[model samples]
Target: MRFARVRLAGALAALAVLSAGMTQATAAPAGKPPPPGSEMRNVALDTKPVQSSTYEGGTADRAVDGNVDGNWAGNSVSHTAQEEQPYWQTDLGKSQTLTKVAAWNRTDCCAERLTDFWVLVSDSPITARTLAEAKAQKGVTATKVAGTAGRTAEVPLHRKARYVRVQLEGTGYLALAEVQAFNDEVIASPSPAARKWVKDNPFGMFLHYNMSTYQDEQWADPNASPALFDPTDVDADQWAAAIKDAGMTFGVLTAKHHDGFALWDTAHSDHDIAASPYKDGKGDVIREYVDAMHAKHLKVGLYFSIWDRHNGDSVELIQNQLRELLTKYGQIDYLWFDGWGWQVPYSQVPYQPVRDMIRKVSPRTVVANNDHLGTLRTSDVIVYEVPVQGMPPETNARPTDASDTLDTNRTWFNTTATGAPRSASDITDNLARARAGNSLFLLNVGPDRTGRIPQDSVDRLKEIGSAS
Candidate 1:
């Protein structure tokens, strides 16, 4: 949200470097003119870059290094040797609400290689390893530039994206001088579907209920006995009421965690509440939590861990559990996935297959995967662990939320009575900070051993609510 130039301070060095690439032609490249707008900043300058392939000494970084040297001999042009749909991509650091993309073609020779190139904007990181995989990822928008966009070409782009790719179809060779991306000083927003969760539900509660809660630790052993999970006095209504009274809009219950313990009576695995003594092994914690949240007219969220230590890289088992939750639970609004990309890479359990299943079962559900992916690369929103990551950014480029514990010691699960909860002033201050950054604040309130919110935490929540 701040307006400034991003064209790094090497303007003089860039000009000196570009001179070696130019030919006898004194005239500049020809292209369409830019439409009216605020001052433009080249976001592509010196940013992280990659391409389909590197030819000779031409790396992807040359194109975006603020050098428009058109000749290959100048070492400023990026030439991709691979033939199949060659492309160049850049990460703009964060999501950018963009306006236009200006691409400079090779001037000395091989200008034909830049013909019929496309400008693509994507929400996540792209895969150009295979032509089939590359073609399948049709981005948010793809603008085709005719061959006439010769020399200096300005392609109109009115959209938002984090990753921008410059691609050519049926590539014999893809060569480029420079690529500059401009923005009109507006931060890229999340999709309209996400407005409800990130914009409307700005204040939410994180219910850290799981085997970890019973075992009195952040993460309990995978082999922890299911019989130890007994919560004889568990009350979902109390949890829901306390959240509602605190003026929160949503709650994320831990349906299953890294230990492979399912809170519901999941048929996929017997390591669930059904195997426990709660309600004589007939308890469905998710069922009660969902019903209670819905009764109070609040959005529902479920936290499911992808890195199941007990299950051991079982993708099919993950899919079946997700299917059960989506189909059985009515209108679940959010899913917080943990230990996917950070703990376990996506190569083991591909992100697309799991994403496809979610799209089919519940298209509207917002997924906030807590895998420490800084941006909204593989998730619908960014999850900032307030304790671990400190605080959310001063300005968020995409939908974001900060999750922290109310316990003064910052324990996520109930290890002891929350006798010293965060003060109302401290909690409300963070809430205001997140709101100012246009993000949600998911403050955690862990329930104690008897399955009841600590009275001190409840009273503090009310105090914050009153202050608000």
Candidate 2:
């Protein structure tokens, strides 16, 4: 029963000869078969991968070093740090109904973890396009497949595509072991019924918090000391209950703000609740928030800032912590991110990591970056945080649900402070306007120096709650 190596090749050759007439892509030659008592299941050695380059050095400055195998030598794409596009375009030789994308990790001996990645498909090669251009163009769609637990990414195919590209972007080094593309029928776009469901639910909360909250400021203030975090009445449960009472369906709290202060307990950095001054600082705000929201049957969201004010060397630290948050938390429904950051330039760096985290942690939850491109890329919904309401419908302002709707599905919602409420009528008018446009109204309440929701705000919420 022991088959020599040569016999395995021979067996593959025989299979290829038998299948040649029916299949377009040729199979590997039959060779030495499996050894005695060994089992090989579903082993189809048809297409072997060819390595183009290996980036082992810090940046892409060093020479590309790696072996080239199979047929992808000239067809391979080399990525230097200079090569802004981290994607490799490959053709299946003929038109293929690609159903899946298998990305191989080919890195030098020193390559670290992969920071992030995304898959883009088009009948033609994907050229660089701005957020604007990507929005305007059609036939180009991408799905984020990084930061997930698995390596294989299944892409349903509806239309035939000759060329497929895998774009890798993030903090880590780069290399591609191999890419296997499967063919199948392309998938149709989302239905109108799905769009309608999301549009009806308007008015959600957007919480922007960070270590600055430790300083009682929005963003990190360099002049402020980290020890300034002292809040006696920091009860997330109360916040959630207040939101629920006001008829809000979901609440998005800032897990980490621009100052990189994580609202929850984190293993990566020391800047978080662990270091705060609430109840000797043993509280995890995120945990309480999640528990409270679930208690109220309200959707829970975590807002993270891609921008960090503290040390920026820990990109890997950042991603690992995020993975923990998504996997550990029971059910996070949304991921909100900012575009501007200290480490990566917005234009140069892609938000694939954030998108990937959302997909991996909570596939059902929508992921939105600060840039409107979130609407174009991985986000199922669009959010315009503009305060002005009842503006005439424009293309940029058009709803994802309908062309005529000023605020339709994937629509805009207001997330700004409503100043001091001179009277209950002001709050009522703002709420009515938001409801009229079919948009969510997220009113901001600036907490007092003690980190307690202002009594006036609480009174106002009570008034609003009674009205709702």
Candidate 3:
């Protein structure tokens, strides 16, 4: 597991931004500090489930630390021999009032099985200690009534505990998904606020798996013949299940990479999975992906490259293709449109056309055209591709989150190839560094010649999960 240090240039720019905003206090809103002596220590204990937040219709792709080629359906699975702590912790720096504590899970309603939910609180920071130490801690757990999927548990003001932790125990079973915490007793947020939450999440998973695996390239040219596209095991459920296990908030799969190869059966495009060698050339990869992810109550992100390397489609033709993709897929949360070397001189013109098409198709969806062509181009979330090093300052034009750096606010995952190896210390430190910067680490475990994620990537991801 090899790793690269974050480039200094991006760090400096972030510092500059901090300096500009120095006058504003960066503390949490007014709240009473926890009582003295009863401080938060070893907070992430096994007695209570951690409150996690997850986006619906999302996907995850990876394997467990000790296991190989296995994908857990959801993240809430409990550990009997060893209990891994959740990724987050809270310190009662200052005791605040006691009104309401809301817990946010991956979804409001369960797709099938029911999971027991509770909030646990203790005056301690959950350290990376042994499970025995955590079990010894003094904490309180509250059982919560399950609500609809993607909704919050707005339980009334209960007794005030010095420390508060949200726990979700599977209904005597493994629960796959996320849980998040809310300070307010009541949960209320406008659309923009919700968008802020998504942006704040910063880190997410971008999965690039398809016939491209056989091609051994990112995406094939749209003009490339379908005869060249093929896959042996393309399991949508596995992809989503792996991602959820890795504790990723959401996933953006390459429904169609730059090659213009549509994973789903698209009537608008002759070049797609239906014309490929998988599932008798009759499967809708995107539909299967959407259904699989939605069943787990995860948020969905579709990646459609603007430049079709294979389709041989002209700029105008590609625009029409994108329109069809956007229109065909309903209830999408995020649309990832990359604008890198792919957008040369001629390819730039289709930007607005693509943006207009996305709005017409899914106006509610958040479109991130990081390179400056999409409608939300000026939007706060921009993806800066760190080719070899970290993100460059030039890439931080707007309030964009640096994609690979540790400093990005929301979810900036590491999408580097997985062939190489880095030291464990480097990987651990860099991920910690990223979390310190308020960015979530995204590990892109590229798949092999087959559709499965490479063993090396899966191994590295398990290392990360173990550390978390």
Candidate 4:
């Protein structure tokens, strides 16, 4: 697939006001690094179980039985035949600064059945007997919990609650093998270093050049001939130069898109740059991009789409590719996952395994799923596509980035034709709005098919750079 690169030059000067923006959004204290002598302890084990509804022999108490082997099946058995909203909750005995909740799925089969759900927290006791009654309870703070293919789903809850509940929204069996909870003193935020990076460098550049650039399509057909993919003069140095001139702190390249074309040479797949005519099938775009960014003192990021049209969806395949990207590259500062709802729903995608792999391979790399799931409570960062007017409200809770096209027409890939780029004044205003809302503004500009950013676009970027 193709991506565009945009520069936000005045971000450094905007930080002073941006800091104030973060304060205006919320009075809550910023997340602090974990103190010494901190450890996670399961607080929900053996807690009293409360349920809105349950299937045959699947009682609420079974959820907290401490036996992960026993599955607690909810009301629905089939997708078409299911409860309006099945739910299960537990009494934490007392109010606590709830940090995280881990839910285990039945491993025998049909893990995809439990797709979308929510984790609700309440300070007061929940006396609701039915699913509808439980959902109607007031003063209950809830966070959406996306389903996963892995056996367990761990979600962080940076809120206070005495009663924790899991509510299912989809039309399918709402089953859980186990439910565990922990307080902040025990469990801490996963990536504090990554969060600091976002706060320090609020603006970045996105490079979208790939096989699709040759085809002039957003997503190239997988069956298309690999020989057609070729750039006349691909220079990572030129891209890095533009980024540094624009005052961006980091750059993310599309290493692999929905079409499953790898920009880097990979031994795993034939549908990669290694199969293309570029560099006589010996070139490695990712290696060059990373080196170029490092040479410019800019952090490196890679974009990979989980939905692959060329290679059929497989968790093993995705993890293998991720292992290569995380291990082969020196260090990936950011990992962006796009094409969420195209091939498979976000819940069905195996995020737990991927997350584990990222943590193991590159502990510092920040992970962002383009699903816009939630603010800080959701993914590492909330990514908005073509947010010209500005980002939506609730995005202020966590670090956020809004990406838009530099060309007013909103094209992602460069065309032979030229167009007027967004004016400097307009671009800066967009940055201001993003900053005020506590978000980084990522501007996109498609490089030409010859692997060269259009001269007009570069000129406009230079104007933005100097003006900022």
Q: Each model's C-alpha lDDT?
A: 0.75, 0.46, 0.45, 0.67
Task: Specify the poorest-scoring 10-residue window by lDDT in model 1.
Answer: 1-10
Best by lDDT: 1
User: Estimated TM-score per prediction?
Assistant: 0.63, 0.50, 0.50, 0.60
Two-way TM-score contest, 2 vs 4, winner: 4
Task: Please give the clash total of every predicted structure, in order.
Answer: 0, 34, 75, 4
Q: What would the per-residue lDDT of candidate 2 be over residues 297-338, giving only the tens digit for each residue?
A: 888777776666663534476577678778887877666655
What is the per-residue lDDT of model 3 for residues 196-269, given as tens digits with 9 covering 90 to 100?
53445544556766555555444444566776766677667776766676556677777776666777787767
Model 2 weakest 10-residue run by lDDT: 1-10
Model 1 residue 95 CA deviation in Å: 21
Highest-scoring model, TM-score: 1
Off by over 4 Å in 4: 1-191, 375-378, 387-395, 416-418
In model 2, the number of clashes is 34
For every candidate structure, what is the RMSD over all alpha carbons to the true structure, in angstroms?
A: 16.8, 18.5, 18.4, 13.5
- Runs of candidate 2 with Cα error greater than 4 angstroms are 1-197, 213-216, 222-224, 313-315, 340-348, 372-374, 387-419, 422-438
Kindly provide the TM-score of model 2 when superposed on the true structure, using C-alpha atoms: 0.50
The lDDT, on a scale of 0 to 1, for candidate 4 is 0.67
